[model samples]
Target: MAEKAESLDLIWEVTEIARLIGRTERQTFHMLQSGQLPAKKVGGRWVAERGTLIRFFMETAA
Candidate 1:
């Protein structure tokens, strides 16, 4: 039997969030550190819930 790949319910790294927001990884990290973006540390990695990112865009777009 073959193992199935895990399905991710959220983004758990700055690089992934950067790609989603069209920003550089370094920029994402800066935002995270400055509290300009929403994220939480899980298992030693920073993660952002998908809904949170979408809400951020909606709020900022308004």
Candidate 2:
């Protein structure tokens, strides 16, 4: 059977964002709640846009 590929345009869930940033899901949630991170509610779930996250990291690093 062939493996399924992930969609690049799909929004990332909190756990995935946590893994990407090396943080816990709770920490990611806190950041979202505190407005330190940008996210949107879609279908009752919080999701972060990949481009927004990349820009946020770039701005913070500078």
Candidate 3:
């Protein structure tokens, strides 16, 4: 489905997620390990949804 394909693009690697959130890799990893970030460990790598991260920051920024 088109939605499925589009969803694929929403998945971001840890590095990209860190840059988007303006945090260093170490900080991002720490947050991920502590369950502070809206991400999950997939296949031994941290993966996060782009929109979810954006929305999380937007909501929390208020």
Candidate 4:
């Protein structure tokens, strides 16, 4: 089962995000590099805020 929002980590790695979005890791990385996805590099790994990603897609969705 998934953790509750209050217990969930605010940050998500590229692989996790990829799974969430139903895309492969490579595709997710490409989107991140091309500015299509919002993320930041920390300690050599790509990460994004759960809330930020949710809002981004919600606001920009067609």
Candidate 5:
């Protein structure tokens, strides 16, 4: 489905990132604010690359 392609995007919003990692937006925002996730704030919005998140979780899961 086209929905799956969202994960292939280079930039993702907090909600998207939350879904990717199977967490809630509140939790994802906390992780981003605490520097637990590799991301940056641009134009007052949180953004992250799907690949980076995937690899980060993959590595952490090991």
Candidate 6:
């Protein structure tokens, strides 16, 4: 289905981002709190769009 394909494309929740960056959920939350990671609060959950996350990585890498 279209929705399923979209979901598979690219999306990162705090847990996923933590796993990708080899950190704990608590650490990831700290990054969010410190304004190091690009995320948006949606329905009481933090989420990073794929593009924003990639951009954040690139910028921070520099």
Question: Pick by TM-score: which candidate is best?
Answer: 3
Clashing pairs in 3: none
Candidate achieving higher TM-score, 4 or 5:
5
lDDT of 5 at 42: 90
RMSD of each: 5.2, 5.7, 1.9, 5.2, 5.5, 3.7
Per-residue C-alpha lDDT of model 6 across residues 21-57, encoded as one tens digit per residue: 6779999989987988877667777777766677778
Runs of candidate 1 exceeding 4 Å displacement: 1-8
Could you give candidate 5's per-residue lDDT for residues 13-56 as a string of tens digits? 89888998899999999999999998999988888887888999
lDDT of 2 by residue, 1-62 (tens): 22323433445688887776678999988997788887776777778767678788889999
Per-residue alpha-carbon lDDT of candidate 3 for residues 1-62, written as tens digits (9 for 90 to 100): 98886766455567887898999988988999999998988888888888788889999999
Model 5, C-alpha of 42: deviation from truth (Å): 0.7
Which regions in candidate 6 have their CA more than 4 angstroms from the true location?
1-12
Query: Per-residue error at 54 for model 3, in Å?
Result: 0.4
- Give the better candidate number (4 or 6) by lDDT: 4
lDDT of 4: 0.80
Model 5: number of backbone collisions: 0
Q: Which model, 1 or 4, shows the larger lDDT?
A: 1
TM-score of candidate 2 relative to the true fold: 0.71
Q: Output the TM-score of candidate 6.
A: 0.66
Whole-model lDDT values for every prediction: 0.83, 0.75, 0.84, 0.80, 0.87, 0.76
User: Which should have the higher lDDT, number 2 or number 3?
Assistant: 3
| lDDT against true structure, model 6 | 0.76
Highest lDDT: give the candidate number: 5
**Over all chains combined, what TM-score does candidate 5 have?**
0.80
Model 3 worst lDDT run, 10 consecutive residues: 5-14
lDDT of 4 by residue, 1-62 (tens): 45575664556678898886678989998998898988888888888877788888889885
Candidate 1 local lDDT, 10-62, one digit each (tens) = 88799998988789999999998898888887787889877788789789999
